[model samples]
Target chain A: MVNWQLYLLMFLPLAFVIVFNYVPMYGLLMAFQNFDPILGIWHSQWVGFQNFQQWFHNYQFWPLIKNTIALQLFGLVVGFPVPIILAIMLHEVANDKIRRFMQTVLYAPYFISTVVIVGMLFIFVDPQTGLVNHLIVSLGGKPIFFMASPRWFRPLYVFSGVWQGAGFGTILYLAALTGVSPDLLDAALIDGASRMRRIWHISLPTIRPIVIIMLIWSIGDIMAVGPDKAYLMQTPLNLSASQIIPTYVYETGLLNAQYSFGAVVGLFNSVINSVLLIIVNFIAKRLTETSIF
Target chain B: MEWIRKLPKRSTKGDMVFDIVNLGLLLIVCLIVLYPLYFVLIASFSDPTQVNLGHVWLWTRHFTLEGYKVLFATGSIWRGFVNSLLYCALSVAISVPLTIMAAYPLSRKDFVGRHVITVILTVTLLFSGGLIPTYMLVRSLGMVNTIWALILPGAVGAWNIIVARTFFQTSIPNELLEAAKMDGCSDIRFLIQIVIPLSKPMIAVMTLWVVVGQWNSYFPAMIYLNNTSLYPLQLVLYQILVQNQSSIGITSSPESMAAQQHLAELIQYTAIIVSTIPLLVLYPFLQKYFVKGVTVGSLKG
Candidate 1:
């Protein structure tokens, strides 16, 4: 017999998803309509692909795509492996007390607000007056404008992200690593395998599935370069380097009130992210025999 | 013979060297993580001129609580802090119970629509309507610029639901639930009496995750909140950190030049430190739970 209580309990979460997530997808038609509040979606004029073209032809359009893709690629290239290495290192830590302490400290930055992290960066990189510059000058080196310089922005963003996030990211792999049989490790040890060899030959292969799943998930979120961190960092000083698709969308839609154009740009970004995720998932499934699906 | 030859002597010099190098690298990683936080704390106490000159690092050269004095002087900062606390508390209260209930049914393999429910939730994690649609929905609900916009829109994240459900399925045995059912315990009764008691670690972990997510959150506050008064601590602190010069409101002062200069260097760093401290204080108590929660959540279903 079907339980009525189950239905009652499920109501709130189900209702919330439908109301908030599914319903607003109707708003995506705002990209097509000259979406007026008074007329609403059904009555608004269908300009079709005009809004999408507006984003495509904008002077800054290619740069936005370039910046967004480059940053995502940079994050994946530099950041994708650190957590795996960290998980391995953490797994090797003989003492639970120090391992736990290190994990706690490593994750401290992840809990810090993004704005705060960027702020800490600003302090760290202050040219003549920054701590980094002071250290450089004290040791006889030139001060550099780390935030203002275009070249440094991506590295700073990606590295700081790794430092902040790698620990938290390792949690999953470590969990998977725990499922590896101790007997297997003992066998490897008896065969004269060093810790590094055991990790490479045994520990790694076991956790490979979890790693691929996470990588796929991360790639799916690639286009979602957070607007807050990028936006907050984009002073006139760093504007050229920091300008990306999300910020462009925000400026076009919210700041300049080009709602249609902004929606089109955002929709385009989402489409690109979705396509990349699918492609990567296909590749991963082919290569590793693992998929998010 | 090959295995015996391949085996290195225990506690060899090469192994000791590798261990030392590894330990050193780990220490450096810890220092890199820790120093930014330490520097900010010290700089907030140090003289602004000294801080600007990069004199403050490990300790404040001129220790004063002046930055805190100035930070707390503004009524707006305190108001934002309270709003943030209220928002986090309310969201946790709503989210924790909702998640438990939603997760409980899904955890049961015998639940009629378990796979369907799981697929429905997981799909959202992989794809969403993106920001604009979500915002439009919030606006349509008349929740824009309200605390409800913050809480109700994100009551149940798909990732968290999966995590909670995984915790339940793995940790809570079906035998226990069946026994409870045999004793004539209803679903709600079993949830309250059996599931909750056994699920304390997961609950603690989930609460910590949700609470941290809420507290450190700035983006939703930035978008949904039109009223400056409704702005959370992170948003206000973000404003301070972003527009380093503008935050001080330094007009018509006898010491205008010095105050302006001091305000620039100290405020950003100080604001960051202030924003981070509250959550860090709560971390040690919750760290074990967080690790456990993350571990459980990350395991593939």
Candidate 2:
């Protein structure tokens, strides 16, 4: 009954996780050390709480937290409802072929890489050659330096995120929507219910659990905004708005070669993310009886 | 039933208005999504100066292959392209099998230690050692600037394992495994001959996701590889497109400075197209599987 073959299959993957996932956790000890590459983790001078205290008191700490939270909040607030709305709209399209075609067109951008997306943003918004500026000029307005101005960073980031991800994000909601019974919709129709009313009463309620789950997941991820696109979109002029924690870790840790300090900052971010996830999950379970636990 | 089938679809004035509004909004959303991509395509072919002046809007004006010509001639782009392809291949090779191996055991309820192993792996999905420690570990392993640096550290993701486990559990019926066991089929033999062959769709989904993920990723390369030759396409594109550094080595004489600048701008558009074309080409064929992957993965295990 003991599947020794299954145990053998598990061995390599377990080894992989132990080395790749857990070892780095062991490497987290470097956060408490005045980590020297030559001295390594074992020999490095242990300075308990020094790195944490240093980061907590650092001048950039509050700005980093503020920027990280601000971007994530903006993304969640602006980006969250878009997919739900999109899914509902798609569901309402009675013409199957038109719905499919629209879905295809919308999802195409999701395949574009982050580098290309940011690159496209720069090209389209460029002061001289960009089409957006051209439209502005033709419409009797001055050209705005979208990439350079710190003011434009968050909007640009969040909107571009929605543009790329909203269509793709609808996949889950649409899947849930399809599970709504035709019999229920027919009954609503027989009662002479309007399309809007039917959707409000039937489709929305059907997908509410999915919506709640997604919202909880999004809330949990509020502190863990990816550094890739933001880092790519970052310019010297936009650093004030773009210098979030992950990017800060990359800059100060690897780029600046402050390994231990970078580790401390990254550890801080991860701890906050973990704590937030637990808190959000617990709250969701209490309120909605639906959680990602 | 006959009357129900034959009757015209019921629509009140309110429903008509709602449908019109919904379709109108969706049409706008579709255009918003499509235009930027269309503009990039047209701009790539248009004259760089004309593009800059906004003379080329809906279509290419003074159409030229000059930008693409410049891009194709660049050694870094070519190197980056090959490097990216190599990394993706290596990553897919490593990740797909590792995912299957990890997922299969976890999928089996009778497999001893499954719960403990599942919990161990799932915990990784929630938290990690963070970037710096991971980077330090990679550096300590002397994977810096090597191909292994890009592919090895992230070969198996906990999420992918979970997704594949879900697939195995749901699709590969327990009865089939028991039947195979009656014939004295070993677990490895059953997996190779029965489970894997039957799970083609799941494998395709996993492979496509891994390939796409590896293709698009540049963070690992940017972090670990110091050598320009090992740089992936995204990293190279980053320098060219994001930093506005011209990888095309055009001589900058004072008189030709404007011309050089124009060519550089053209190359940026061209680079975006070239780098993106592969994924976009594969997307239509692969989209269903991608959708399936998302839906299957999203299901509560």
The DockQ scores of all candidates, in the order shown, are 0.48, 0.64
Q: Tell me how large the interface RMSD of candidate 2 is.
A: 3.0
List ranges where model 2 is wrong by over 4 Å.
A287-291, B1-8
Q: Write the per-residue lDDT of candidate 2 for residues B4-121, one digit (tens) a residue.
A: 1123378766766677788889999999998888888899998988888999878899999999988898999999999889888898889899889999989988887888988788
lDDT of each: 0.78, 0.88
Residue A186: error of model 1 in Å? Answer: 3.8
Off by over 4 Å in 1: A139-141, A179-181, A187-192, A282-290, B1-9, B245-250
lDDT string, candidate 1, A1-293, tens digits: 54667767878987777776677666788898776655766787889888877777888888888888898889998999998988887777656777778878877777887878887777678787778888888899898888888788888888878878877777777778888898997787577666677788998999887787777777777886768778877767767778998888788776676667777888888788778777877887887675655
For model 1, how does the per-residue alpha-carbon lDDT over B165-189 read when each residue is reduced to its tens digit? Answer: 8888888888997797888888878
